[model samples]
Target: MGDLVYFLNGRKAEKIEAVTFADLRMQESDIEEILRSSIDMICDDEESMLIVGQQVKNEKNGRSDLTAIDNNGNIVLIEIKRDRKDIEGRKEAFEFQAIRYAASYATLESTEDLVKKVYAPYIEKYRSEFELGVLTSYELLIRKLNEFLRVNKAGKSFNKKQKIVLVASDFDEQTLSAVSWLNSNHVDMSCYKLTPFKVNDEIYLQTEKVLPVTNYEDYYVNLMDKSLATIVKRNKGGTRRTLPKIDSMLDWGVVKEGDVIAVKDRDNEGILLANGNIMVNDKEKSMQSWLKEIYGWSSVQTYVFAIHKESGKSLSQIREEYMTQQAMEASDDF
Candidate 1:
């Protein structure tokens, strides 16, 4: 008879020689190895480009683990845990150890040094499948780390924000709660569960839940949608201010004064006297309301009439001239 037998996923139970659960939990490295092997499945379709190593030591703190880089040259710090033991507690060990590793390589400057130090020994000493894997991982980490550092120095930090990653088989309530709390507080991080299952005596690693990277702030989705829509709108039209400008005009009462606005007509022979005075086409009502808010409507009308009288042209003619001038100026940019 086999040592142990258990129903797996409630599908046609099979009895076989069971590896001791204690043996599985005994060596932390074994669990780490499983995760290291499972990374391909874990990182699939995620921002992660290439995973460098499982337990990358941080030179600065002398204590750290998983480090990776994404396709866009962003750094990802990972921490792995199998289960709880008597030493320092499981979740605590995973969290703090990863944080220490993350802190060591938190900024771009330190990440490069850490990458080299962790990979150099492996690159020099080994010659096998694992060694080749390490080499490939090192190359990825170095390339991205260098590129990320270069971009950071050039003020591209927003696009290269670091991601702290945690991978584990099981997390206790405390660990999950802590993670959720950190996420709520706007920490840039994510957690993944790695599970190993046996089918016909062959072990296979599977990736479970991939947690949200960060918490949702008020109007965050709306703001992101607005930003993407603005970019698309810009590519489509040569003359469209963003939705934000319209928003500001309505919400903040900011007068819509372009640097050199354009109002166009069929004729192109006149000077653009009404260039700076033009606002958005739809803001006339709210703009007039603002004018009334600041000064009376009669004052605004008088001012408008005075501008026309002084220029010796109708408002329409002034606008057409302004648009013609703007058309000429816009062509100069190309």
Candidate 2:
């Protein structure tokens, strides 16, 4: 891992030296406690996950650091290690420990068992966080979990798969190799490198996904777009163009509010609204939520799957047609 660098006072570049957990006198328990409630440190915002259990125990009585239910209806086992030796020195590999707990979670078949085994114990451990005045029975817990699954729109795909996430300050060679091999065989496993850097009295952490190299094309495009926006800000009387959103589609006359959208190859339909949420089965759901729920995909491209009932054209097609007409009207290269 490289030292994290940042601009000091927006004037000179400064290196924030990396430090081990031992140097900070922090233990694995400290990191586990912090991540239990803040799963976003490892997960992206779009991939919704709820931490239903912390220190979840397996059949062998091994306690997992965290257990979560992801939006894709997969049970997620998140295991964290403080430093490199915290993982490499173990008899059983750190990754194997997480995999064992994840396998135990796979044996669960119903939401009731989930509520009893995970959610109930989690609620017990974090009682102050909930408003359970006289509602501490299993009935209430099961009901609440069911409601959560339904409201999240994950009910249809509940327990379809299991996901494994391993986090550490640094990874060992064996751990990296195993995770890569598992991913190649279609196992939904990932690793996150969480490095801590100390700057004076303050400590900051940098997180990176080091395995299964993904395309960063969109990330770079966003950086270039930010640069263009900065140029616009500096130029007098120049304004930055915003990314096209649902409102943009309405303005471009591609689709209107209250238009019915039919999901391709599916019987599902929704009534589009100005706010970008669609009315699906008497409930307002975001276009992306509807798409993700039906497809059981981790991410969704709303416009690609949605078709305007009246025009009989997919949202992507209509958007492209509108852009083509605009380009033809302008007929000039920038």
Candidate 3:
């Protein structure tokens, strides 16, 4: 890592020195506490990851740093360490320790089990931050989990898998190598590097997700840019990305109202309406909802799954053609 510099003026700059947590005399507990309250530091609006509990104890007679449930209802184990020494000095490999903790979550039989075991305590611990009405902590936990699942339309896949996230200021080479192998072998694991910087007496931290997470829901994939649908068989490089909505397709003139769309090999079809909803059985639904239902998944690439009957092509193909044409025209302008 390099220095973090801030420009006070066009010609003047202030260079902030990179510092270790030890340099600032900060304990790993401090980092855990911050992350327990601010998991968003490692996440963005595109994804949802709610930290449910911190220092959660497991049957293994050890306590996990933090636990979260992602939008797709996978319990995420987040373990934090200060540096390379902290990660490698453990009796077990850091990754192995986290994997053991995560394996314990796989035994959860139902969402209710999750509520009773993990989230209920979180509600009580953070009671002041929430508005708990005439309900017990367990009820509040259920409400929170259900509401999160309902809002993201992820109820169907609640707790289907467990994911591990390891955070440390510095990771040893072997740990990263092992994590890479695990991810390739279909283990949902990620490493996030959290570095600290110091300026005068103030210390600041930066977080970055080190490995690109593999797409869990790879039922559909779009090889094109965006705003359309395409389908291909799953392969090793199935990375999930942001997909464009029907509004973008309409803007690009890929498809318009009165057009018919259907999922591959499905006889029943739906009609695209002017308001960007698909009409099925006289009921209107958003393309995302339709796709999710068809795929029976919490996260589905909608545009890829939808086929435009008029063009006999995927909206992905149409959008790809339009982008290519636009790019060619733009080049001719030069």
Query: Could you list the CA RMSD of all candidates, in the order they appear?
Result: 22.9, 11.3, 12.4
For each candidate, what is the lDDT? Answer: 0.44, 0.74, 0.73
Off by over 4 Å in 3: 1-10, 213-334
> For candidate 3, lDDT tens digit of each residue in 148-229?
6775677888888899989998776667657877877889888777888876676777776655445423322234433211
> Which clashing pairs does model 3 show?
229-303, 229-304, 229-316, 230-304
After superposition, the stretches of candidate 1 with alpha carbons farther than 4 Å from their true spots are 1-26, 59-61, 84-93, 110-115, 125-160, 213-334
Q: What does candidate 2 score on TM?
A: 0.65
lDDT of 2 by residue, 116-233 (tens): 8888988887777666777765776777667556645789888889989898888766676677677767888877878888878887878766654342121122322445323322
What digit string (tens of lDDT, one per residue) describes model 1 on residues 88-183? 364345555555666655544555455666544543443343324544766754554465344224224422556676776555444544555656
